[model samples]
Target: MEPDDMLQTVDSVSFDRLVLEDSGRMAVEFMSYGCGYCRTIEPIVQRVASMIAAEETVLRVNIAADPELAKRYEITGTPTFVMFLNGSEVGRTEGPAPTQSAVIDAITRPFMS
Candidate 1:
């Protein structure tokens, strides 16, 4: 399918199935539908998510839709980007990175080691 379609929101059973069970590097975006920053960075996030390795899964979680999940992640605002490795958070970015390069820089920084 298309690159944009690769980024999906994981919630409840889906989150457990895709991220917890798989046990690998994962990228998750926590966002809200009404947030301006979330809307602005979506395209850049999508493109970066697509270009990443197949073994790495890109996920999005809507805070409004899933408040419990949001609380669990400690997401206090919109457009929070988190990188998971072996089912644990290894990196995170709060607020809009604005550019693709910044997003990539945040997401891949942990893996550089």
Candidate 2:
């Protein structure tokens, strides 16, 4: 798939649906539209997601538009990634990071053997 195809930016409603009905494991990045840090790491997240898109679902949710979802996850920062497995949260990583590798590791660790 194309690189951009690896990630999806979803709305509050869709986010809920994806989180609950995703067939396999998934990771969602909670970011605000005006967050500089979130913008800076957007490409990094997309690239890493592309690398593992075959095995996982990667998404980005605009926290500003999804306050309730953010509250449910207890997200306090931009660029927070919450990973779900079988419709249940399994792991999470918060804040912006220096590189995609570290963030990717953090988001995927729970499903790794």
Candidate 3:
């Protein structure tokens, strides 16, 4: 799938169904639009989404708008990547510094390995 197609923009309202309720491995990026680090890693996240297996998915949560969700995840950074498998969190990487390898490992390592 295209990079954009593989990445889904989600919010607190839809987060449960899209991420926590999903039956496959997935990565959810908790971020904020005004966060420079979040913006810096957006492209790398998209690229990682496209590179991962088709059954896997990538979702993004705007912490600015979904503060509750961010709080639920205890996100203190702009680009926190959380990996879930079969509706439960399995791994996480809080920041990637916009590095492709870091993003890839953050999103893929838990399930891909």
Candidate 4:
């Protein structure tokens, strides 16, 4: 997939339908515009997105723009990666990941099978 198409940005109104209601596995990065880590890890996230299967989705939620999503996800920090399976959260990494493999291992490895 194209780099731009790798991570789709989502908001509270669309979050429920796009992430929560989706039947397959979905990974969401809860981030904020002002977060340096969010920006730093963006490339890694995109790379991870490219490595995932077509059935899985990668998304981003800007906490600064949509505080409700942050609150609902109990996001305490920016760049929190949450993975959902069948509309329910299965795993999460609540900080910046150093590498693409780390991001994948933390959030997607378990669900890959």
**Per-model lDDT:** 0.79, 0.82, 0.82, 0.83
TM-score of 1: 0.87
Considering only N, C-alpha and C atoms within 3 Å, which residue pairs clash in candidate 3?
Answer: none
Of the candidates numbered 1 and 4, which has the greater TM-score value?
Answer: 4
lDDT per residue, candidate 4, 30-103, as tens digits? 98768898878878887878888576788989899999889988999988889899898988888845687788
Give per-residue CA lDDT, model 2, range 1-113, as digits (tens): 33545677777777768776776989988988699888788778878888888888888788888888888889988889888998888888888474977877877898885
Q: Which stretches of candidate 4 lie over 4 Å from their true place?
A: 1-5, 110-113
What is the C-alpha local distance difference test score of candidate 1? 0.79
Per-residue lDDT tens digits for candidate 3, residues 7-37, read: 7788888888888888988889888889888
> After aligning candidate 2 to the native by TM-score, how far in Å is the CA of 1 from where it should be?
16
Number of the predicted model whose lDDT against the real structure is largest: 4
Query: What local lDDT score does residue 4 receive in model 1, on the 0 to 100 scale?
Result: 43
By TM-score, rank the candidates, best first.
Answer: 4, 3, 2, 1
State the lDDT of candidate 1 residue by residue for 33-102, as single tens digits. Answer: 7999888988888888878857566788888888888888888888887888887778787885689898
Best TM-score among the predictions, by candidate number: 4
TM-score quality measure for candidate 3: 0.88
